[model samples]
Target: MGLKLSGNKGQQSHRLVIFAAIIVLMTLLILYGSNNVNDAVYAPFHVATNYAIKATDLKKWSGKDGYVPFHGNKTMNLQCHNCALVTSSSHVLGTRAGKEIDSTECVIRMNDAPTLGYETDVGNKTSLRVIAHSSVFRVVRRPNEYLQRPDSNPVIIFWGPPNKIGKEAKGTLYRLIQRISMTYSNLSCFSITANKMRKFDSLFHRETGRDRQKSHSWLSTGWFTMVIAIEICDNIKVYGMVPPNHCGKSKPGSKKMPYHYYKPRGPEECVTYLQNEGGRRGNHHRFITEKQVFSRWAKQYNITFTHPNW
Candidate 1:
């Protein structure tokens, strides 16, 4: 027999292994202080948030000099779910009529249209308004069911898909934004169709709600872009939108951007809906990603939090 414990049974087995490791570190700090979630995580805090938003002046919301009028009546934050900048003034500018007018005349002559051209008199005064902003412009059925679109080109959903359906998005949102708009045609272009939100609420008087149930409504054909440098462009320059569920370093079988497509939804279908116990007096807490529920609703609606680094 080699004999073992003697010092009061080895100090009561080292005080019961320090009381079971302080009860497993207080149950992992009370489940990481009640279900961990502080991730603004834009790629590890985007270089200290782009140097604190380049010391806040943000180019006055540059479209270069003018053009800020795409207001489809109120409901700003452009497309909510945490809305960032260009918060409101509710984009309603116009001018872009030269022919193809039908979404009830692109919602009543979209401000008199002309910075790139098009208009058969959308109440033509001289034409050059520009500014549409997207959340999801409706209409789709094509497999030949006859609905297909991509004209009216206001940079329609950063142009993709077989070059507006000729053939090629098998993967990698086609070298991100169709090989850079086939070598840069003003960065990420626009112009999407399938209008109908009652002519986008009769071209901005506002009231077209019924898209139904929610998850990504508003007609969802798909599009997302925001380059606005920023100045006084009101409601915070829609903080140059980027958060549509980023992918970046491009992995997990690369080739993305059909609309920046993604998958991930495990862990028992990733639950949500606590709402209150979180938000803890607005210091913030409740989130299930969508860029931390739109960056805590863009800092609770003050808007302006653009941090996707480059």
Candidate 2:
């Protein structure tokens, strides 16, 4: 016997079916849709995080003029994880920190400082060199000693006024450096341009209220080296550097040290600094004043002075 359902019964059955379908849909959404939604929300965040990291890292080596080659147009960023700035001061004479300094990723030295004779005090690794215009003569005079390195040839950067090291300028020093580069193809020689030097002057003035030209204080090679190190190094440890108040801390009848580690019996380091600090500003290097600035910078940046740690 065929029977037709009443309208109320049919309606209740349809409602039950609809409720079951709704429950299935919700279940599927809970399992699958939530993950899809989370992925959609997280992709942008992942990309943004990487972008932030890259930006902060670039800030470490940006805005400053990079290490420029003397022969080519290609500029180098000169980045290092650990940098050891081995100064020319005599404070390193007895530190016995050569192994520790050489252990760093890069070892930076100033003009014509020989590591062979004093390897015990100054490490024999020269990953980079920053030389003054005046010291160009010493370097070229002993090309075999300073220019060529059997183990590794570190890049050399000669900083000077434009008239002395400029491309168009003519002088014995300029010609000699150019000739040296041509002869030692392995040697990577770089020069600081006129514009870069002026930028450095402006930096010094900004750090110290006095105008560099008006103050008549030439920026020391240590100043240049420290500035560049700040730009490129992730962490810097200055060896044999002294604090600004170091001179004041000296006691009467205290033992003395040479002006340079290489010159054992030369002028005393503290005595020279005191003389320059008080001398006519016409041609002096205000070493004490520069150290004061450097101390502030060390606190500001990733620099630390060792061999009398600051």
Provide the TM-score for each candidate, comma-separated: 0.23, 0.77
Model 2 per-residue lDDT tens digits across residues 1-310: 1235577788889999999999999999897988897665432111122222111222343354644566656455567899999999988988888899889999999987888778888888888889999999888888777887777767788898879987658577778887887788767887887777887786666656656777567888988888777777778899999888887899989889898888888899998887776655356677887787777677567889889888
Q: Candidate 2 — which residues are off by over 4 angstroms?
A: 1-67
Best by TM-score: 2
Q: How close is candidate 1 to the true structure, as a TM-score?
A: 0.23
By summed lDDT, which 10 consecutive residues of candidate 2 come out lowest?
A: 45-54
Number of colliding residue pairs in model 1: 50
- Residues 248-267, model 1: lDDT tens digits: 33457543222111112212
lDDT (0-100) at residue 44 of candidate 1? 27
